[model samples]
Target: MDTQCGDLSAQSISNNYSTTAPPEPVHSTGAHRTEGDENAGGFGELTELPIEINERRPTCLCCGRPQKVCLCPFMPVRPLEVSTCLYIVQHPAEESRVLRTVPLLAACLPPEKCKVFVGRRFNEERNPELAAVCRDPKTLVLYPGSDAENLEDMKVDFSASVHNVLIIDGTWSQAKDMFHRNALFRLPKQVQLNSSISSQYVIRTQPTNTCLSTLECAAITLSIMEKNKAIEELLLRPLRALCSFQLQHGAQVHHSKEHLLRNGIYDKPMPTNKRKIKRMEQLVSNSTL
Candidate 1:
């Protein structure tokens, strides 16, 4: 990939955003039904909801947030466009999430600069563009594997080389599964952020100490690679404000699940078999009837 730096210094910002909300549920009365209706005697002639409940809410296009929690006002005036490309392999499930950071990241960069590929498996045939970037010699995958090198330790000639940075956007387990299953990801040199700075994603619970939101991870990586610390602050402005707004409006400040378990503030439940035995027994008895 060519490092053709454009004149992004004069980029203009816009604040226009959509205002929409989840449609309120309208109810109608009908017969109730139970599970396993194929076996017969499942229908109940009682008043019940006839309409299917739709949980998905309308979102603002600019911020990709629910109208109520839209963070467009807090977004930066202009995105800090960089020379390096950011390839985000996102789980398809993440698209419907109300509170996601990918949109914010997208808003900060040009479409070509930040590319998102959504799927469970990223094969060369399915995603040729992503595969090509992964195959590039300068490309690096941001992961904390045993053989991973710290971001700061790996020196790069920015002017001579434009790196294709691969970031997997998902929960810890989902990301791990994607990384393990995807052969393309395995080819790139893995890099990790060794800095001790804590995550500012207060609205969501991180899994571990090193875990970060996709936006935060990308911002930090860009800041380090571009040698401009301002990118981190610029990208995070809306995120921080989003968390603050949510906190003020009754959202609790969440701690990582690991932190909660370690501090004894919350306990990990027993194994699935032990925990669900009673429920399973009751379900079996009900089914027999």
Candidate 2:
């Protein structure tokens, strides 16, 4: 994916939106020395390598910062009443990757109110409350238009406003699996999102036209239900994070001319040969994954 710029180096897409990411940690000189000897161990698999360091710091995929320093004020430390509580169900496999935005949404919505669960089996993580919500009889799910009831004809107690939306978070395939495997039919109202905006995830591909990243879909659906007023800013924050991550990772795979900063590709500053040897040796000795 690298676009050649004289020489090749991984350019991170994160920098594009990292202005909002948390600040880097400040480690003392003594901390580095103490952690050195123990760090030198085994290295073999490419997947095992710590890609999150040097090129990839432990930045929040959503906020683009170390988890400890999440500065996004919207990250819902508490449930700020925006008329809805997102039931964000995630596929466990996705937790390892940075693609999903539901976890990041925790920063915007009430951490406790915005629940997350993952697994092959649903009963494996059973909760009376979750079951109640979907089955609440009063609750409504937004599935595809064909099988779903019309949104316009939807009738709710408008005195408070219709707030419940079951957001299934993942790739299209993953979402479908949640629908079938989990007996989403039991849900109050089935929702099928008809979205115009194409997805923005660059690392992975998905079905076109009818697809959207969870964040984009969330915002669109919320905007429509709220009459395009409530919680718009909160929804947009996660959307921006996704764009930034794409830019960061895209650059990492393909170094742009302007972003070339001589990271420790070579151990020493001047000579290329000796530094190359040392870097290789260090890479070999370091414990991966």
Which stretches in model 2 have alpha-carbon errors above 4 Å? 1-64, 67-80, 150-162, 200-204, 248-289
Task: Rate residue 193 of model 1 by lDDT.
Answer: 82
Report every candidate's CA lDDT.
0.72, 0.50
Q: Which digits, one per residue and each the tens of the lDDT, describe model 1 over residues 1-289?
A: 0000000011244433323332333335774544444223322222222433345566677766667777778777766679889998888778766567887788888888898888889788888888899999899999876889999887777657788899888876678788899999989899988777777888787655446789888888899889899988898888787778778878898776556655667565633785455533433343210
Q: Per-residue lDDT for 37 in model 1?
A: 43
Question: Lowest lDDT 10-mer window, candidate 2?
Answer: 1-10
lDDT of 2 by residue, 1-289 (tens): 0000000123455322222323334567767533433333211232244444346345556555565444355454544555655666666666655445665556566665466655544642475666767766656565454567655455654337445666666654566666678875345677555444545433344333234566656666666565554565566665455446456645333221111223334332543688545544543443110
In candidate 2, position 107 carries an lDDT of 57
Every model's Cα RMSD, please?
A: 14.2, 18.5
**Whole-model lDDT, model 2:** 0.50
